[model samples]
Target chain A: EADIYQTPRYLVIGTGKKITLECSQTMGHDKMYWYQQDPGMELHLIHYSYGVNSTEKGDLSSESTVSRIRTEHFPLTLESARPSHTSQYLCASSDSWMLSVPQYFGPGTRLLVL
Target chain B: AQKVTQAQTEISVVEKEDVTLDCVYETRDTTYYLFWYKQPPSGELVFLIRRNSFDEQNEISGRYSWNFQKSTSSFNFTITASQVVDSAVYFCALSGTGNQFYFGTGTSLTVIP
Candidate 1:
């Protein structure tokens, strides 16, 4: 089954702790994105990658950073977590072309900074 | 700037009833794409349907149907004979030529037994 996966489905950490959210897709998609969302709120894009060694910050300014070392992996890291960073982080990937090319999302990792 | 608007914050319907979710979009580009996704309580986003700017052809998948109207920049989804399993949050999204997407706040639907 080709699908996107995120690790640590739920996380609670101290405010100053450093954490990394893992995302991997076996679908071999070239475009991958990271979005932050609160419960029942609109998704806000935080980072994206076109391919390996290519990454870009999204419209919403975020303190976290992402890396695309491999096509199947795009991980986001926060050097110092804060309470404001508590939210659900979703990972998505899609092919470049198609009639719609709707993104396929992962199950998401819910983070709580205490 | 591309934007998507879903005016209905929440809706409730009885099982076997029909319901419609409205989506409106704004974009400067002539060509763009629209999409609908369902998020259940488990928090997984499921892709439902997609429509492009040039094609206004309505589509039906089982009891689910979509209406796309380019004139009004609207894309609406309707579920006929709804069931309890249809309860979820539906989101409408738009993406321009740049490949960046904008999404609506979403509409929450609840189906009563």
Candidate 2:
């Protein structure tokens, strides 16, 4: 089945530690996005990629960065984690289309920084 | 700026009761896309419905229905004879001239048996 996947569903790390959240999709989508969401809160876009070797920051400023070295993978890395980074990170992908496009989401990774 | 607003934060209803979740959006673009997604306790979002700005026709799938009104910039979802399994957070989103989806603050629904 075509689906999106995320690794390290749950993580606990000390502040200032380096971490990378992995996201992959088998749907052959060209556009991928990363969003930050708190428990019982709204989703805020942090980063996105158009395709291989194409990445851009999202509406909400984030300390983390993302890379799209391959079309099937988009990983997000934080240089130094902080308590404010404690939240669920969601990955999504959408096929190329101008109108009426629907994005599919993956199981989120919940990170806790202490 | 594109924005989506889901007014009801949380709603609780009996298993057999009918419930409606309201969604309002704001966008300057003449054409846009709207979507509804359901997120269970497991925390993965599942797509429910998608409608374009030109298609004002209402959609019905199983016991779920969506009302999209371009004049009022509203897209509402209704679940008929709600079930315990229907308990989850529902979000409404808007896509304007790009790949990004402006999501609303989700509406948490609890269906009690």
Candidate 3:
């Protein structure tokens, strides 16, 4: 099945710990995005990648960074975690050349920093 | 600048009743796209419908229908004969350059059986 996947659906970590949220898609999409959302709140874009070796920050400023080493993989890493970083991280991918296609989303990873 | 707005914060309707979720958007690009997504308790977004700037045609799928009005800058979704499964957070989004999507705050819906 071609779908987006995120690892460690739920995570709990202490503040100052280093963490990486993994995201992969089997759909072979070229554009991938990472979004942060609080429980029952709106989603905010944090990072995105156009393709391999291309990454960019999103509208909302985030302490985490992302890398796109492959077309199907985009991972986000936080050097030092904080309580403020506790939120659900969602991964999405869309076709590169399609203008009207909707993005395909993966089940979010819920992180808790104590 | 691209922005999407869902004026209704929350709504509750009894089963079998009809419900409508409103979506308004703003953008400078002449060519753009609009989308609606459903987020269930599982927290994954499911795409419902997509429309373009030039297409004003209304669409219906099963018990769901969408109204796209470029004149009012609105693209609304209506679910007829609501069911418990229809309860979820509905979001409206706008893609101005097709590279970025601007999402609304989302409207949470509850259906009472």
How well does each candidate superpose onto the true structure, as a TM-score?
A: 0.97, 0.97, 0.97
**Model 3 per-residue lDDT tens digits across residues A1-114:** 239999889999999999999999998899999999997788899999889999999989999999999999999999999999999999999986566878889999999999
Query: Per-chain TM-score of chain B, candidate 1?
Result: 0.98
lDDT of 1 by residue, A10-100 (tens): 9999999999999999989999999999988999999999999999999889999999999999999999999999999999999885436
Model 3: DockQ score = 0.75
DockQ of each: 0.68, 0.78, 0.75
lDDT of 3 by residue, B2-102 (tens): 88999999999999999999999999999999999999999899998899999999999999999999999999999999999999999999887846889
> For residue A106, what is the lDDT in candidate 3?
94
- The residue-by-residue lDDT of candidate 2 on A1-114, one tens digit each, is 239999989999999999999999998999999999998889999999999999999989999999999999999999999999999999999888666778899999999999
User: In DockQ terms, which candidate is top?
Assistant: 2
Ranking by DockQ: 2, 3, 1
Docking class of 2: medium
List candidate 1 segments past 4 Å from native.
Answer: A97-99
Candidate no. 3 TM-score: 0.97
The candidate that wins on lDDT is 2
Q: How would you encode candidate 1's per-residue C-alpha lDDT over B1-113 as one tens digit per residue?
A: 78899999999999999999999998888888899999998787899888889999999999999999988989999999999999999999997867877889999999999
lDDT of 2 at B43: 90
| Ranked candidates (lDDT, high to low) | 2, 3, 1
Compared with the true structure, all predictions reach lDDT values of: 0.93, 0.94, 0.93
